[model samples]
Target: MKKTFDLVFFLLLFALVTACSPTKFATEMAIDALTGAGSSTAFTGESDPELAAQSLPFALKMYEALLVDHPDHPALLSAAGEGFVSYANAFCQLPASMESSWEKQRHMLQRAASLYLRGRDYALRALETRHDGCIRLLNEKRYDEALENCSKEDVSDLYWAAAGWFGAISAEGFNMRRMAEAPTAYALLVRALSLDEGFNYGALHELAIAVLPALPEAMRYRPNVAPADDPVRTWEADYYHGLGIDPISDPYRAAYHHFERSLKLGEEGLVSPFVAYAEAVCVPQQDYEGFRAMLEKGLAVDMETRPDSRLVNTLQAEKARWLLAHAEDFFVVIPDEQSEE
Candidate 1:
């Protein structure tokens, strides 16, 4: 009788334990379901930046809530990190760029910086979770292992980590503390470039293009300039620097090449590359015709077919429109094409 009674008691205990466990387990499962569903909806609704801007906060909260219970979930970490980056880029940094008030601009920029740092930290956390001791490896300058340890599949994490780091550095502007992090960001993206040059339709190349041209002469490491007998060898010179032969390296050409490669990789449906090429390369070079052609290329993209890219293209197209409107500010008139002769 005691043996039978003990068996019944243990069975009841087992049932009690499982029944109690299901509440937390089921809640977590529900959170996971909600997160995936919300993310899918957000991706589908990509046409309006304002709508994205409005919805991101809620999505971020959902990610954070999930993270509280499931801190090491790679998907959650990535979503949180990318969410912060998208928010800062679309809402914070863009507006901050336009705030002419010194004090207000400074305030806006600082907020953007905070968001970038948060994103960077979250992305780093995701990496650390993926690879044990990764943070220590990175800090110790064990870049070989840090870069090699991650497989090709981890490209998004690497890219976003670099993006967030660079975003923070850019927002800091001249602040020496954050500016020092640029090389770290550069290394991260370089690793991503090595893993997949075609990642995100050449977004990796776009990022490197932005950084390469803006590198301070001191920070830029380049090979010795080739002899003048071989002008073609000039192309062999590192774009960021050229052994001081030119005093300042001309990275713009190389940057432009990346933009072209990006467009080719993108094939169609992406307009940001065109806008970026015009603003960062053509306009600065005073190539009015090239600038106009690039913007027209951006405007020509059909946003509906590429709905997933619509929001970014919309924002980029607006910039292209603004640049066209202010064309006179960037270029000088040559009177007539034949007059140049």
Candidate 2:
């Protein structure tokens, strides 16, 4: 709940872990590795994104191999769930977000939908591991009922689950069944937002920027997502959030500073901030050159120099390329036709 990945708590937690068996030792190791800045789950340092991307398969298999023996290990479940979400984010969704061709984009979205759902399942496992019977209740469509059993400590896993669910629903396109599932995901996210807007340094807000706006325009600001009572904090939340208000109508005075803060807070070299600003603000305002410049800046970030999020940077840079190529799709150009005759 306090976040910052309290190393002390885990140290004490696993101190009692005798690790009498190899399985137990392995699980303990996985937890430790996750906390490491260089681990696949950690995504920190100047590690090569390509190398990191390549290593993920083995890393996931590492988790799965352990899960076979310790199905209910909370740390393992949390790491694995978060890992899957990151994988989908950096892999499946990146291409989907960038694909200019509708048919290809649809195919990619379908693929992304499955990975996101798998991530959601793992998140649910983590949640249920933490809060008994929560997943079972969730399976029966009792989301709020299930969430009632959660506390502030549950925010990370809740964000993971709802993020995956919402992303899957978003990529899968509009349908009655998917629409029906939205409220549950909505409730989970709102709760997570309330509990920890600082989770991963407003990473949840990155999701919120997309999630809140994806709803019908009229319903964007439901009671659940109302600004906090404290005006300053509410304003701060809105700014760091990727979209940062109506980019179309409002110039978003603090948008640049907001993104700068977001990058400083969590993603220094990550491509997400660049891509987020490009799509959320640039496209809406029809600032083609600005969008291109933002993307170019993201591309220029050296993975070897400041590899905060290599896979994400690489993937999002790819997105920037696609957007540049498809610039006309998002902005209109007035044909300089003359015929004054």
Candidate 3:
């Protein structure tokens, strides 16, 4: 009888320990169909752009269900926000088809802007999970409250969130509704720079390079504008120094700086930066060689650091298609008769 009681007690204790173990829970979750391993399988298919594009809405729905269970999950919120932004920009609003119809392009661009704003809202909610209320305040257009909430600790998310907000404003134009939100966006970006100068691997520097020089004199009161001589001098100085020269009136300096930084980061096996650099910087500048170099480097790096980086592979395939389509324009011919003459 004593031996049986001892055995029963040991069995119960073992069962309790196993039930509470985090590793066990994680392993179980990893295989769970609803919220675990199956989700990873979905992500694995993202290597194909067409498949990824098709799967995005499904993936987002899965995330939404997970969020219902784990309502405040930061990763889920970030994924959802980023998905909307990407889908809107990459598929809906691409300006390449503008040659066919400007009206269609304009409508698509408006849709992209709406999606970006939605992304901003979701990102703001994610920030709230970390107790950084700046995101919420920024959305509310309470600049002073937002600035007060912002601190050095929140720099990473703050940088990205502010960039998204500002990009939306820039792309869509600042009406009264957006104008109310502009100050908070400006203050948050300023705080991001103050906290971490190297945030986004100096992508902010490129933004400054692009916007400051061409900043309309009238819009200086809006976010991200400053006197050319402001003491904090981050964006301007980094832009000039990164490019090794100043093109006072040229937006191309920003493009050059961003592309260079992307190349530098991608060589270190950071693939997304390379893709972004190619799309946002190189293509905009019509720097076909630069774009090709960045894309090739991205593919090489993706094979190492992020082997499953679907976006990198997509960018590489796109680059190949682009090169094939524009081979004639990309190659220069020197006629023998002209050379002799």
Candidate 4:
């Protein structure tokens, strides 16, 4: 009887160990699928976004399957949410050329928005697992309630929650349902600043500069400050002007500051900031030379800091291809008289 019991116990222990091993494999598979793991081997050094994008759906499916077994895994939840958003943005929304039909663009945008909303929800779930009540209040658009829940010790949570709400609100069109939330979006951002001034790496300074200057005359009223001492109007001038905005009303200045900061930060292999800077600030200002310079610098730094940085490699190569394809469009010709002068 003792011998028989020992054999049964060993069998059960082996079964448990085997089952546990698959969970790690599933987790790794989920990450690999999201990040284009083996795809990096194909090009010797760099991965292709097109190929990476193709792998995303399969990876996402793997993540979903894994979630069935490990439902509350933080890493899995965050990865799944981000993967959905990235796949939607990269494959669906970003490929529309000017020649593409309007219906296609509309469909893509809507899909992207939905994916972003999913990401937002998942990120919220991750927060909720930690018992963060601020996220719940923010989701309900109860800004004051959310603010009241915030403490100085956990200000980062407050900032991110407000940012998440802003992102969700911005994803919608001018529907009557969303219209009421517009003012609240701006207010929430302000509240985030009040709670944590360093939110967005202080990119809010640029955001404020960009937004305040473009406000319609009537909408520019300083409800947040005294009539004689409105801080928003002055902030619009100071930060924007410092960033090289001519007439101090240009939104592009805000972009310039943020992009510059991104490039500086990308020294450690953060590429999104550099790419965003190029797209939002440099391209809009017709600063092709500056854009090209920044991208080259970004690529060099990224390579040095993280030679295996797959996303950085892909984005840099794509940007180079873009510059090559649209060389003429990016260049401006000066008149002969102006050139001579």
Best by lDDT: 1
Best by TM-score: 1
**Shift in Å, residue 287, candidate 2:** 4.6
Which regions of candidate 4 deviate over 4 angstroms?
Answer: 1-46, 68-71, 97-99, 144-254, 268-275, 282-305, 316-341
| Clash-forming residue pairs, model 1 | none
Cα lDDT tens digits, model 2, 56-168, are 65556666666777788777777777777777776677767766688898887888788788878878888887778887776665544677567778887888888888888
Q: Per-residue alpha-carbon lDDT of model 1 for 106-218, expressed as tens digits?
A: 88788888998888778888888878887677666455566666777778878888888888888889988677666557667767766677887788877766676676644
Give the alpha carbon lDDT tens digit for every residue of 1-341 in model 3.
Answer: 23432443354355468775234454234224333322433443255666666756654564564565566776666666655655655555443222257677667767767777776666666767776665556555444455545565566556556656665775576566664665555555555656665664464554444444434333423445454534223443553564465434454554465556644643454554555555555665666667667666665664445444455445545654454355345345323445677
Q: Give the Cα error of residue 277 in candidate 3, in Å.
A: 6.2
Give the candidate order by descending lDDT.
Answer: 1, 2, 3, 4
The C-alpha stretches of model 1 lying farther than 4 A from their native spots are 1-23, 34-44, 100-102, 220-250, 327-341
The predictions' CA RMSDs to the true structure, in order, are 10.5, 8.0, 10.1, 9.5
Model 3 Cα RMSD, 1 decimal: 10.1
lDDT of 4 by residue, 146-210 (tens): 55444443433333333443444444555555444444445444544555555534534433433
Tell me how many residue pairs clash in candidate 4.
0
**What local lDDT does model 1 show for residue 44?**
35
Ranking by TM-score: 1, 2, 3, 4
TM-score-wise, the better of 2 and 3 is 2
**Candidate 1 worst ten-residue window by lDDT:** 230-239
Q: Would you estimate the TM-scores of all the predictions?
A: 0.77, 0.70, 0.58, 0.56
How well does model 1 score by local distance difference test? 0.69
